[model samples]
Target chain A: MAEHSVTAAALTARHQTAGSAASVRRLPGFGWSVGLIVPIMVLLLWQLAAGGAWIEADLLPSPATIAQTFWAMVQDGSLANDILVTVYRLALGFVLGTAAGTVAGLLTGALPLARRLLDPTLQALRSVPSLAWVPLFILWFGIYDTSKVILIAVGVFFPVYLNLMAAIAGVDRKLIEVGRVHDYGKLRLMLRIQLPAAMPLYLTGIRGGLGLGWMFIASAEMMGANNGLGFILTNGEEIGRPDQIIVAILAFAVLGKSTDWLLARTAERLTDWQDKLHPETGA
Target chain B: MTRRLDISDLTKAFGAAPPVLGPLSLTLDGEGITAIIGRSGSGKSTFLRCLSGLETPTRGTAMLGGKPIRPAEVGFVFQEPRLMPWLSVRRNIAFGLSHLPKPERARAVEAAMALVGLSAAADYLPKQLSGGMAQRVALARALAPRPDLLLLDEPLSALDPLTRERMQDHILHVAQHIRVTILLITHDMDEALALANRVIVLRGPPGRIVLDVTIPEHDPAYAFPRDRTSAAFQAMRRRLIDALEPAPVALAR
Candidate 1:
C-alpha cells in the first residue's frame, strides 16, 4: 500500500508538471482531443435533424434517443455482456494471430530458403480481403464464435506479417556485420541484435493488426453471431428498432476508440523516446 | 605477450580474374600502429577485410600470434559509424562486451564512455548524436573489447577537417593508453604520417608493397602542417606522395 501511494504521488506530480508545461507552451490539454470535435459536431447535427423533422424521426433517431437507448441497454446488462464477448474474441484473435505472425515472420525473414518459399504464398493470401472469407469460414466452422474468431484472426494476421517481414529485412546490415565480427551465433544474432532492433516496427504492426482485428470482430458478428455489438445491431435491424441500432453503432465506435487509445498510451509509456510523435507530450 | 601477424604469399582472385593481391608477403611487428597508404580501389580495404577474416583468401593465409585469425579476435572499425538506432550511446559501446559478467561489463562500459568523453551523453540515443560523436561511439565500441589487434578501414576518412583532427588525436590518445597493435588503411598521406610510426605504400597491379618508411618523430604532438613549409616535413611528404604516383612504363625490370 505504501509503494502504491508512492507511485500514485509520483504520477500526480508528473501530471501537474505536464499540465504546467503544456500551459507554458500555450498548448491545449490533449492534442488528439481535437479529433472529438468532429463527433460532437455530428451529434449536434444529428440532434437538429431528428428534432426538426428534416427527415422521418423513425428513419433517423436523434442523439438523445440513442443515448437513452444506450442507457437502457446498459441498465439491463445486455450491452455489457455483448461488449465483454466482443472484447474477448478480439483479444483471443489478436494473441493467436500476433504469435503466429511473429514466429513466421522471424523464421521466413532470417532464412533465404524460407523467404523464397513462403513470401509468394503469404503475399497472395494477404491480397484477399477478410470479408471474402466469411462464407468459407461459416461453411467450415458454422455460425459459432469459432468462425468469428478465425475471421478476426485472419484479418489481423496480414498487417503483422507484412510489417514484421519489413522490420526484419530493414535491420541495418552493418550491425549484423558487427555481430559476425563479434562471433555471435545465428540465434544470438537474431535475438540480441535483430529482434530488439526491429521492435519499434513490430509494435506498429501490432497496433495496426489490433485495430483491424476489432473492425473484423463487428463485421463477423454482423454476418451471423448470436452475441456482440454486431448481433445487437442486426437484431435491431430485423425488429425495426432504429434507436437500438444507433446505440449499437455508437458502442462499436466507443470500443474501437477505447482500444486504440489504450494501445497508443501503452506504446507511449513503454517507448518514451517515441513520445515526441504525439505532440502533446512535448517529447 | 606479443602477437605477430604474418601474411605469407597471400594471393586472392575472384571468378576467373587475375589476383587482386598476389604472392604478397609481409610480417608486421606487433607493438604499435602500422598504416597502409594506397589509392582508392588499390585493394587495401580488401586486404584488411581478409586480414580481419571477413573474407577468405583464395590462396595463402593470415595468422595472428602465429594462430589463424578467428572472428572477434580482432576488433574492426569500418569507414562508417554503423550503430543501431534503437540502442543508446552507452549500449552501443557496451555492445560487444556482453561476454563479460555484469560488474565487469558495467566497468568496461564506464571505461569506454570515459575514454570517448561520452559519459555525460550515455543515455542519449544515437540519432541525437552528431556524426563525429557517433563515429567516436563506434571507436569506443571497438576499443571496449580490448582486442589484441585493431583493424581500421580508413575510419577517419569520412570526417570533416576539424572533426578529423580531433578524432586523430582521440585515436592516438587511445592507442597510447591501450597499447594494442593497429593496422590502419588510409589514402591520406598526412594522416599516415601523423598517426603511424611505420607506413607501407601499396602500388602495382596484383598489388605489392612498393615503399616502406618509418616516421622518425617520437611523442608527436597534435599540430599539423602548421609548419608545412619546413623542409624536413615537406621532403618527407613529397617522398610519400611520389611513391603514391603511378609507375612509369619506361622502367622495366
Candidate 2:
C-alpha cells in the first residue's frame, strides 16, 4: 500500500509538471521551431538545386558559397549598418503614416460631410503607387532619409486609412443605440464603445500598414538613399556581388515577417477578448 | 403618479406598401402585462416597434407618461438577444445603465442576473452561451433598467418547448414582483393566454385589432387555465381559436 502511494505521488508530480508546461506553451513558443526549420529547408533545397546540377552555378550559387559570403559581410560591419538604416526608416515612416491615417480615417468615417468632401480626393491619391511617388518625394525632400521615409509613409497610408474608415463605419448600430439609451455623452460613446469595438480592425490595419511601410522603405532606398539595405544591394551590383544582393533581399523578407509577428503578439495581449474569432489570422 | 399610455389613430407605412398599422387606437391603464398576438407578417411586431419608438408613426400620436414617448424610456427585447459580441453576460445586463455609479451598477447587475437565473454565468461571453441562456441574458439586460414599460418582440420564439414554459413562468413571476408594465408580442396564442391579463390580436397588412380578451383570473399560476381539464379552460381555448379563425367562417357560425 505504501509503495503504491509513493508511485501515485510520483505520477501526480509528473502530471502537475506536464500540465504547467502545456499551459506555458503558447504561440510564440512555436516560433523558434518554425525559425529552425525554414532556414534549414531553404539551405538544403538551395544546395541540392545548385550543387547537384539542377541550376546554373553562376546564376544560383551553392548554399555553402552564400554562407561564406554572408559570414564575410557580417565580419566587415557593412551589412549591420545597412540593416540599422533600413530599420530606422521603417520605424519613422510607420509611425507617421499610422498616426495620420488613423486620425483622418476616423474623422472622415464619423462625419458625413467630411466623407463626402474628402473621400474623392483621397481615393485619387491612393491610386498613385508607392513607386510612382519616388520621383516626387526626391524632388520635394531631396535624395536623403526624408524622401525615402516619405515614400514609405505614403505606401503605408492607403491601407491603414481604408481599414480605419471601414472599422469606424462598421461600429454596431445597436451598440450606439444602447449608448444613447444609457444617456452617455458623445465623448464617452466614442471613447468607450466605438473605439474599443473598432480595435480589432484597426490593429489588423496597423499590422498590414507596418509590413507595407517596411517594404516601401527598402524599395525607396534602392531608388535613392545614402545608407540602408537598399544601398548595400546597389553597392553589390556595382561590385558584382550578387550574393550580397540576395542576402539583403532575404534579410528584408525575414525582417518584414518578424515585425508583423511581433505586432500580432501585441494585438493578442491587448484585445484578448475583443475579437475572439477575428476573421484574419484567427488569433 | 403612475402614467397611462394613449395611442391614437397610429398609422405607419414602409416603402411603397400600405400602412402596417392604421387608424388604430389603444389606451392602456396603469400597469399590467398586455400580449399582442397574431400570425406571422400580421404587423404585430411592427405595432410593438411603433410602441417602443423603434419605428415612428406616420400619421398618429403615441403619448406615454402624459408626454410624447421617447425610445430611451421604453426598454425593448429584440427577436434575438442582440447582445454586443464583445461584452460579458453581466456587462450586457448593465450596458443600459452605464451612467450609474460602479457599486449601484454592480448591485443592479447582480439582481438582474439573479432574476434570470444567470448569476453563475455572469462572466461568460454571448457566444459561449446556449440559445436559451443568451435569451435569458437578453431578458436580464432589458430588466436591469427598471423601465416604466418593457416591450418584448417575440423574445422567446426561439426557445425549445420546455425552456419556453420555464421562461413563461419566469416572466409571470417577474410581472408579479415588479411594478413595471409589459407589452409582449407573440404569435403563440398559448403564450399570450398564459402571461397576459389582456390579449389583443392583429390581422393583415393594414393591421387592425380583431380580438381583445381579458382573462378572468389574476393569479400567475393557471392564469390561462386554472385547470386544463375544466370546462372554463376548454371553452376559453375554443373561443380564442374561433376568434383567430377566418372572419367569414366565424361570421357564418
Candidate 3:
C-alpha cells in the first residue's frame, strides 16, 4: 500500500472537440419563422372564405370576427380574469401532480417491492378517464376548487408518473457502473448520476402533464364554474355566440403553445450537455 | 505507489450458469504493469470485476498488501469512457476526489488533467469531446484519486488504430512515471507486449491464468528500445498465441 501513493501523471495527450461538429445544429430564429408560414396561410384562407360568404359565420366565424370578439373581451377585463383563472388552476394542479408523481416514481423505480405492489394499481387507475371521476368527485369533494383541482391533477399525474418511473429505471447500465466503480453510496449515486440522467425524460413528462391539464379543463370547469375560458366556451353555446366560442378556443390554443414553449426552453437549458442528436427545432 | 494483489482460488458463477471465471490463484507483485490477454469469453473482465468489487466472487479471497481489497482503492477504466453527460471534463475528473476539500479537489483535478494532456479541454463537456479525448478524461478521472491499483478493462478497444497506438505509448509513459500497479485486460497481443512487463494469458471453459511470463524487455520505458522492439515483440506474440492454442482434453470436468 505504501508504494501505491505514486504520482498521477499517468498520461500526457492533448485532445479537443474541434474535430467533431456539434451534432445538434441550430439556425437562429429560422425554425419559428418557417413554422409560422402554414398557420398564417390557413388564417388568410379562412378570412377570404368568410368575407366572400363562401362559409356561414354562424358555425365558423371569420378570423376577423373572432379577433373583434377577442379584442372586446380583452377591453372588458373579463377575458383577463378567465385567462387568469384557467392558468392558475392549471399551474396549481401541475405542481401538485408533479410533486406526487415524482415521489411515487422514485419509490417504484428504486425499489422492486414498491414497484410490484404499486405499479399495477397506478397503471390501472391511469386507464380510467380523468373525467370519469366527475360524478364521484363532486359527491365526495363537491364542485369547489378542491374537486376541480384534483380532477386536473388526476389528469396530469399519470404521464408525469410514468415518464419519471421509466426515466429512473432505464438509466444506462454502463453509466451506473461508473457510479459503482467510484464506491459511491446509494444516496450520492442517486443524486449525482441518477437524478441528472432522469432529467430529460422527466421534463418531457411535465410537458405532457401540462398538456393533459389543459385537456382536463373542459371537464373540470363544466361544474358550477362562473368564469374561465371553459365557462366562456359553455356560455357561448347557451347564448349562440360563435364568435365567443372561437375566442375561447383561440385563447386555449395560444396558452397551450406558449406554456409548452416555456417548458421546452427550460428543458433545453437543463440538458445542454447531453450528447444526443437534438430535435431540429425547439418543438 | 503500487499494490501487491494476492488471489487464492477466485471463482464466480452467475446463478446456476457454469462458472465464467476461476477457481484459480496468482499474485501480482507490487509496483509494475501486468497485462491479462485472453479471448472474449475467457473472463478477463470478470476477474477485474471481482477485484474491483463490482462482482462478488463465489469462492476466493483477494487481498491487497495483506488486507481485503477496498473498492475505494481501485481506479477503473472501462472499454467505453462512460462519462456523465452532464459533467464537464474537470468535474468528471474531480468526481472520485470528493473526500478532499474543494480547493484541493480542484488542484487534484488540474493535476490529473495535466497528466493526461487534457488541461486545455477541462471546461468541455463529454459531448464536445472526440472519442480519444473522452477516453483520456476517463483515465484522468480514475487516476485523480491516486488509487492503489488501476484496472483497465479493454480501455483502448474502442479507439481507432492510430489513437490506440498513441494510448499504448501513454500507458508506457504512465508506467514509467507512476509507482501505481496496473492490471490491463486486452485481447490485443500487440497491446499486451507494448506496455506491460508481466503478461498473463487467460483461457477457458472456466477462465484462469494459463501462462504467466515476466518479459522484462517489454518495459521499453526503462530499457533500450529499437533492438528489442521487433524481436522481443515477435517472441512474446508467439508465446501468447501458443498458450491460446486449442487443447485436446482437460484433466477432469
Candidate 4:
C-alpha cells in the first residue's frame, strides 16, 4: 500500500523528461528523401548551365567563379562580419517585436476592453503595407541601425499579435468549464488552461513573424549603411561583379533555410503531445 | 466523506427561453450511485451542469449535508474525456488536487488511478489512449478530488457498445467501493439500471422528474450490469422508455 501511494508522484514526474513517448510517430522518411532529390537536381542543373556555355560567364558567372568569390570574402572575414551584423539586427528586432506582440495579444484576447482600445489601431496599422514606413522611419531615426531594426520589428509584430489573440480567443469552452469545476482563479485559469491550449498555434505565429523578419531586413539593409549581406548584393551590382552577387544571394538562402529548420525542430519537440499522427510541420 | 444532496425548486433559463430544468425538488442520500435517465435535450446535461456550478440556476438552491452547496465540493465528468492533451494521465488526475498538500495529493491521485484501473497508463497522453482508456482517466481525474458530489454527464455515450458495457462494469465496481454521491446522466436504460441504487427518470423540454425508482441492494433484481434477459430488468427498462414518450392528445368527438 505504501509503495502504491508513492507511485503517483513518480508517475507524474516520469513524463517531464520522457518527451511524450506515446505521441511519438514515424515521420515520412521516404517523402523527405524524395523532397531532397528535387533540390539536389535543381542545384545540379544550375551547375551544368554555368559549366556549359548556355549562360555567359560575365553575365551569370560560372558556379566555380562564384565559389571562388565566396572563399575570398570568407578569407578576408568580410563574409563573417556581414552575416554577424545582419543576424544580430534580426535577432534584436525579432525579440523586441515578439515580446511586445505577446503582451498586446494577451490583453486583447483576454479582455474585451483591451480589444476595444487596441485592436482597431493595430489592425489599421497592419494594413499600411509596411514598406511605406521606410522613408518616414529614416527621417525620424536617421539611417543608422535604429530605423532598420525598428523596420524589421514592425514587420514581425503583426503575425504574432494576430495569431496569439485568435488562438487565445478560440480556446475550447469545455476546457474552461474544467477550470470552473476546479474553482480556479482568473490567473490560474489563464496560465494553466488558456496559455498551454493556445501554444501550438502561437508557435506557428512565431514562424510567420520570423519569416517577416527576414523579409523586412532585406529592404532595411538596402536603404543604407555598410557591412551586411544585403549591402554586398548592392555593392556587387555597382561593381558589375556577378560572382559576388551570387555569393550574397547564396548566403541569404543558407541563413534563412537553416534558421527555419532550427525553429521547426524546436517546435516539434515542444508540441510533441499534439495530434500529429499526420506530419503537418506547417513550418 | 460523501454527503447527501438536497435540491429545492432549482430552475435555469437562458434569456427569454423557458426554464430548462426543475421547479422540482428531491433529496439524494449518499448511500450509493444515483443515475438520471432521460432522452436527448431533456436537460440531463443542464441539470448536471447546474449542480457542478457550470450553469447558474435561475431560482432556488442546492444544499449538501444541510449547508449551501459549494462548487468546489462537486466533481464533474463530461460526455467526452476532455483531458488536457499535453498533460500525462497522471498530471490530469492530479489537476484538481492543487489545493491539497503535495504528499496527500499524490496519495489521492494514486488512489483514483487504482480505482479506475489506469495506474499503468499514467504516462500516456490522451491522444495515445483508446476511447475507453481516455474515459477512465477522466473518471480518475474527477474522483481524485474526493468531491462530496460527483456528476457524470453521459460519460460513456461516446464509446462503442462493447467498450460501453465494459465501462458500465467499471463504473459499477467503482461506485460500490467508493464513498461518493454520484449523479449520473445517461440515455441508455441498461447503464442506469446497472450502476444506480436510485434511478431518476426525467421528462421535458422544460425538464421534470416523471418517475424516481429505488432498488434496494438486497433486492434479487439489483444486479451489476443488470441481466438483460431478466424479467425484472426488462420491466423496469420499459417503464423508463414509456416515461420518455410524449403525452397522448385529447380526441375531438
Candidate 5:
C-alpha cells in the first residue's frame, strides 16, 4: 500500500511538473560548441578562400582584415560613437512608435467608433512601405533626427497597432463574461481582465515592432546621417573599404539579435501563464 | 442577510428565434440549495444567466428581496471554472471583492478558500490546478463576495465521476455553512437529489418549470448520498425521472 501511494504521488507530481517544465527550464545557454561550431567553420572556410585569393580581397575582405578594421575603429572610439548614435535613434524611435501604436491599438480595439474612424486610414497607411515614407518624412521634417525618428516610428507603428488590435479583439468572450458576472466597471474590466488576456499577443506585436524599428533605423540613417552605423556602411562603400562595410553589417546583426533576446526574456516573465499553458512552445 | 427570490415571466429570446426561457414563475426562501434539472437546450443556463444579470431578459422580472435582481446581488459559477489564468487561486477568489478594504478582502478570500478546502493551493495558478480543483476555485470566487443569492450553472458537470461526487459534498457543506440562497442548474437527477433542498425541472422551447418539489429536511433518506436503495430515496428519484420523461403516447381517439 505504501509503495502504491508513493507511485500515485510520483505520477501526480509528474502531471503537475509537465505544465511548468518549459517555464522553469533555464533559457538556452551560450553553449560554446553548439553556438560556435558553424561560425567557426565559416571563418575557417573564409580564411582558406582569402589565403587562396579565390575571391578578390577588395571586394570581400578576409575575416582577419574586418577584425583588424573593427579593432582600429574601436581604438579610435569611432565604432563606439557610431553604435551609441545608432542605439539612441533606435531607442527614441522605438519608444515613440510603440507608445503611439499601443494607445491607438487599445482605442480602436476597445471602442467601435474609434475603430470605424481610425482603422481604415491606418490600414491604408500601413501598405506604404517604411522606406517609401523616407522621402516624404525627410521632405517634411528635414534631414535632422526628426525625420529619422519619424521614419522609424512610422515603420514600428503599423505592426504594433495591427497585432495589438487583433489581440484585443480576439480576447475570449467567455472571460469577458466572467468579468461581467462580477460587475466589473468598464475601465476595471479592461484593466483587470482584457489587458492581461491580451498580453501574450500584445508582446508579440511589440517584438515585431522592435524588429521593424531596427530595420527602419538602417533606412532612416542610410538616406542622410552624419553618424550611426548605417552612415558608416555608406561611407565605407564610398571609401572602397569592404572591411568597414562588413563591420557595420555585423554591428546591426548583433544589435538586432541582442534587443530581440531582451524582449523575449521580458515577454517570458510577463506572460508566464501562457508559458505554463503551452510548455512545449515556451512562447 | 438572506433574501427571497421571486422570478416571474422572465423570458429571453435570441434574435428572431423562439424564446429560450420563461414565461415561468417561481419563488424560493433564499437560504438553501435548489437544483434545476433540464435537458440540453432546455434554457437552464439562460435562466441562470438572466438572473445573474449576465443576460437581459426579453421580458418579465426577477425580484430579490422585493428589488429587481442586480449583478452585485448574485454570484454565478459557470459550467467551466473560468478562473483567470494569470491569477492565483487566492486572487481569483478575491476578484469580486475588489471593492473591499485590503484586509477585509484577504480575510474573505481566506475564508472562501478554506470553505472549498483549497487553502493549500491558494498560490497555485489556474493552469496549475486540475479540473476539479479549478472548479472549486470558481466556487470560491463566487462565494467570496457573499452575495445574497448564488447562481450555479452546472458547476460540476465537467468533473470526473469521483470528483463530481466529492464536489457535490463540498457544495452541500458550503450551502449549509454559508446559508445563501442557491439556484443550481444541472441535468443529473442524482446530483439534484443529493445536494438540493428543493428541485425544479424546466422543459420546452419557451422554458417553463414542469415540476417543483422540496426535500424534507427531517428525513435521513433525503440527506446527501441518501441511501439510493432506500424506499424514500428511490421513490423521489423515480418521480423526478418521471417528470423528466416525455408523456406516454395515448391511443388515437
Candidate 6:
C-alpha cells in the first residue's frame, strides 16, 4: 500500500511536468510486425494441419476455406447484415444496462436506505446466470428482438451495477471531507467530486459490462434471433457447414477485439490523469 | 470586514467516555497568525475541526463577528493536501469559489494561483504536482474564497525540511498580506515560535490550553532564522518544551 501510493505520487508528479499539451506517442511499424508474428504462426500451423489431414476438414475448416466463405457471405451482403444487426442489439442493450446500473449503483452507494432496500435483492438476482434469464424473458417478452435485447441488458447490468457501487463506496473519505469543508451541497458533492473520483471504476464497470453484453448477444441470438452472428452460427451448424461456422466464429472474435480496443482507447483518454502519473516505463 | 473569533467553553467528545477536548475558552484577534502546539492525540485537530465546523462540538459556542461560525466563513487545510485528483490546479483552487459569478470566480482562482506562484501549473492535475506544489494548491484553494478564518491542521509537516521552511515563509507572507485570522496547528515548537505572534499549547485526556505565550512583536530575534539562535527564542522554546512534557509518575499518582 505504501509503495503503491509512492508510485502514484511519482506518476502524478511526472504528469504535472508534461503539462496540458498531451504528446501523442505512435507505435513503430516494427511493433506492428512483432505483434502479428504469433497470429501468423498460428495460422500457418492450422493450415499445415489441414493440408496434412491431421484434423478432419469437416470438423475444423482450413483458414483458407473460412476466408473464402467469409468473402462469399460478404459478397452476398449477409455478413454485413448480420454484423449490423448484432452490433445494433449490443449497442442498445449496453446503453440501457449501463444507464440503469449507474443510477441504481449511485443511489445504493450513496444512500443507506437505498442500499438496505435494494442491494440484497439485486445481489441475489445477479447471482443467477445470464442464460438463466432467457427462458423467463422469452415467456414474458416473446422470442423476438425484445427477448434478445432484454437478455443482453440483464447480462450487462450486474457487472456495471456491482462495480459502480463498489467504486462509489470506495471513494476516499478524505476527498469527501475536502468537499464538505468547501460547503458543497449534496448534488455538487456527488456530481463534481464523488462521480469524478469514481470515474476510473465506472469505466472499468462499463468495459466489463460491454464484454458481458457481447457474450449475451450470442446466447440471445442462438435461441431465437434469425439475422445476427449467432444466427449464422446456428444456421451453419444445422447445415453442417464448418467453413461458415468458422467464419462466424472469426467474425465474433474480430468484433469483440475491435470493440474492446475502442473501449480501451476511450478509457485511456478518460484516465489520462491517472495513466500519466504511473506510465508503463519498461518492457 | 475582518472577523474576530470568540470560542467559549468549547468541548468535543466521540462517545460517552472522556472528551477529546475539554471545555476551553479563548479570544483571538481578527488578523495575524496564531499557532497551536501539542503532542500527538492532543485534540488540537479536534479543536481546529470544530472551529472549521467540520465536527460539531459537544458543548460550547464559537462565534465569529458576533454570529455563529459557519463552515463558509472558514477555510481549512488538512495535514495531507486533500486535492481532488481529477481536478486541474485551477479547478481545485476554484472549487470553493463556485458561489461567485463565473468571471469573478475565474478571477479569484487566477489570483489565488498567482499568489501561490502556481500560474504555470494551473492546467495540471494534482497527480502532476510535487508534494510541496500539491500542498500549495490546497493552500490556494483555501484562500481563493477569501474566508475570514483560515484553519491549517499541520499543513506543512508532510513536506521535506527545506520545502517545509519555504512553505512556512510562504504562509507567513500570505498571513501578512491577506490579514486573515489564521489558526495553525503544529507539533514543532520552532515552527510555532517562528511563524505565530501567539502560541498556545494543549495537553490532556480532555485537552485544554496549558500555556499561552506571546512572541515579542518588536524583537528582531523573533523573526525566522535570526530568532532560531537567539537566547530569547531558546528561552521561549525551553519554556514551551517544559510545558509540553508529561507530568512525573509521583504527580500522576
Which of the numbered candidates is closest to the native, going by highest TM-score? 5
Model 5 interface CAPRI class: acceptable
> Residue B209 of model 5: what lDDT?
88
What does candidate 1's lDDT look like per residue over A1-283, in tens digits?
Answer: 3423533454456557766765776545765567778989988988888788897767787888878888999999999999999889888888888888898788787887888999999899988877898999999998888888888888778778878888888888888888877778899899888887777677778888998998898889999888888899899999999999888887888788778778766765556543242333212
The residue-by-residue lDDT of candidate 6 on A104-172, one tens digit each, is: 999988887998999999999988887888899999999988888888888889888988898888889
Query: Which residue pairs clash within candidate 3?
Result: A3-B1, A3-B2, A4-B1, A4-B2, A5-B1, A6-B1, A11-B115, B1-B179
Q: Which of 2 and 4 is the better model by DockQ?
A: 4
Evaluated at residue A32, the lDDT of candidate 4 is 47
Instruction: Name the regions of candidate 3 deviating beyond 4 angstroms.
Output: A1-30, A280-283, B217-229, B246-253
The lDDT ranking, best first, is: 5, 6, 4, 3, 1, 2
Task: Point out where model 4 deviates above 4 Å.
Answer: A1-36, A280-283, B223-225, B250-253
DockQ computed for model 6 against the true two-chain complex using alpha carbons: 0.49
Runs in model 6 deviating more than 4 A are A1-29, A275-283, B224-226, B246-253
lDDT of 3 by residue, A188-255 (tens): 88898888999999988988998999989767886658888889888999999999988988899999
How large is the interface RMSD of each prediction?
Answer: 10.5, 12.8, 8.0, 5.2, 5.3, 8.1
Give Cα distance to truth, residue B177, candidate 5, Å: 0.8
Q: Global CA lDDT of candidate 5, please?
A: 0.87
- Please identify which of the two predictions, 2 or 3, would achieve the higher lDDT against the true structure: 3
Tell me the tens digit of each residue's lDDT in model 6 across B77-167: 9999998887799998999988899999999998887777777778888866788888989999999999899999999999999889878
TM-score of 3: 0.92
- Going through the candidates in order, the fraction of native interface contacts each one reproduces equals 0.31, 0.17, 0.60, 0.50, 0.48, 0.56
Q: Model 5's chain B TM-score?
A: 0.96
Candidate 2: segments with Cα more than 4 A from true spot:
A1-39, A48-59, A72-77, A171-194, A269-283, B15-17, B218-221, B224-231, B248-253
Model 4, residue pairs in steric clash: none
Could you tell me the TM-score of candidate 4? 0.92
